[model samples]
Target: MTTMAATRRMGRQSWRIFSMQARRCSVAHDHTSSSDPKLTNFGYREVPENEKSKLVGNVFTNVARSYDLMNDLMSMGLHRLWKDRLVSKLHPFPGMQHLDVAGGTGDVAFRVLHAIHKAEHRAVGKLGGKSEAKNETRVHVCDINPNMLEVGKQRAHKLGLENVEDLVWMEGDAEALSLEDNSMDGYTIAFGIRNVTHIDRALKEAHRVLRRGGRFLCLELSHVSIPGFQQVYDAYSFAVIPAMGELVSGDRASYQYLVESIRKFPSQEKFAAMIADAGFQEVQYENLVGGVVAIHSGLKL
Candidate 1:
């Protein structure tokens, strides 16, 4: 089938699944005493909520080796542009402290450091100051996947980042961050929020961790708004992506699940509302690459 036709079919299938879910919920409410085990949909799979992390972990573990490659291939290297845009908006100061939650491979953290260094260099050149400058910037990269964190740590070391020891690689859940409250100057997550089963809780955690006026930034795959982009995008995601995964990572099913999860993710407006509900103010989003991805920015006030 053509890309357009395939996308239409998938949209229809998604609608059917939604309808089925509504019917099931209605029936369950009617039979309150029924002992039918409750089921939650995790990317079209009916699984218990508690089981989702393990399943998601398996997907990441399977694709960890080729995850970065897949990102480059799928986005035609535009993912770098999207991330750069996010970093630009952040405009990290030399003294800023950031918590990068779900920062699986420290891509965002590394970019943040680069932005800070560039900003500092520009400031010094503009001012022509001879005073000693202090680099107070620090980033804590937190993720649930230790394997990903280990790889990221090695990459950081290879880059010869002076404060590599300052970059804490913590294994923690977004829903319940282990960090102390009101301790972070900024919080960021890239392409990670959708994998979270409890997005609201995660947002709450973000709010709790961020200091007043601190920024919360998220870069995620969002629903496309263009006339024909969704169809083409879906076709590529569903068809070519898995094949690329097989070729690069020797894992096809993991990539397939990633595509489905992106489809299951909430719309940009819906997600912005969720962020607002979690006490973030001035919530805004910028679409990248014809709305295939979005960078959402909000502040804790």
Candidate 2:
């Protein structure tokens, strides 16, 4: 085909796929709203509250192998810096107990451990003595999807952290964490809350599990409201991201839902309010990349 003709054909194909997904999303929303009061969004589509988790699980499972690569591609490797900022805000300390929820790729958890290790070393350097015992320090990585947990475990093994007792991996739901109250010094979740069926419940659970003065931090994709930039961002999100997903991971539908879910998520201001309502004090948020992402934090007191 001629270059112009091929370009036109590809554009047509992309639009067709986008339209089909939109129709399905609309139908799902209509059906659920009319028939079931207990429904939550799976991207733009509505599904039973209980079923959203399984649907989200399927998406992660399908893209698990390519998750990190796709993140690099979609964000142009900025995700690494974003995660670093999240951990830095966490201010990990030696002999601290931390929980990283929905961090199935071990990204945030690894950073937390690295920060704690550095803190321990710094203490030793300051005192001119051996590092204090960190046997009580632990970083727990919790996620509901077993496949994602397995991926985290495999990555931990490859990084030689499999034998580290301070790093623990568990399969558990964020809304109902299987942890005792006042058990954690810090909590974090990255790029994962948009898929949650009940974000409020998860926030409450974070509060419930944290000790007084513990911090909760969340990094997530959010809305972009800059006038000219919003248009460009929307075009990129609706067009380029799904195309990249199709070419790289052979799963355009999942990426479509992923971006759509970002839109469905609460705004930074509203979410910060939700955290406060969940009994957190000093709730605040910082927007990054013109609000393409945000980090929300709160302290339990």
Best by lDDT: 2
What is the per-residue lDDT of model 2 for residues 120-216, given as tens digits with 9 covering 90 to 100? 9999899999766668889999998888888899999999999999999999999999999999999999988778877778888999999999999
Residue 86, candidate 2: C-alpha displacement in angstroms: 0.5
Judging by TM-score against the true structure, name the best candidate: 2
How many collisions per candidate?
0, 0
True lDDT of residue 91, candidate 1:
77
| lDDT tens readout by residue for model 1, 1-301 | 5754544333311111445434444332322244544444466576776787888888888877777887877676778888889888887877678999888788999998777777778878888983244346678899999888877887887888635654677899998998899989899999998787667788899999999999999999877755465656666777877898899888988877777776666667777887898899999999776667889999998
Which residue pairs does candidate 1 place in steric collision? none
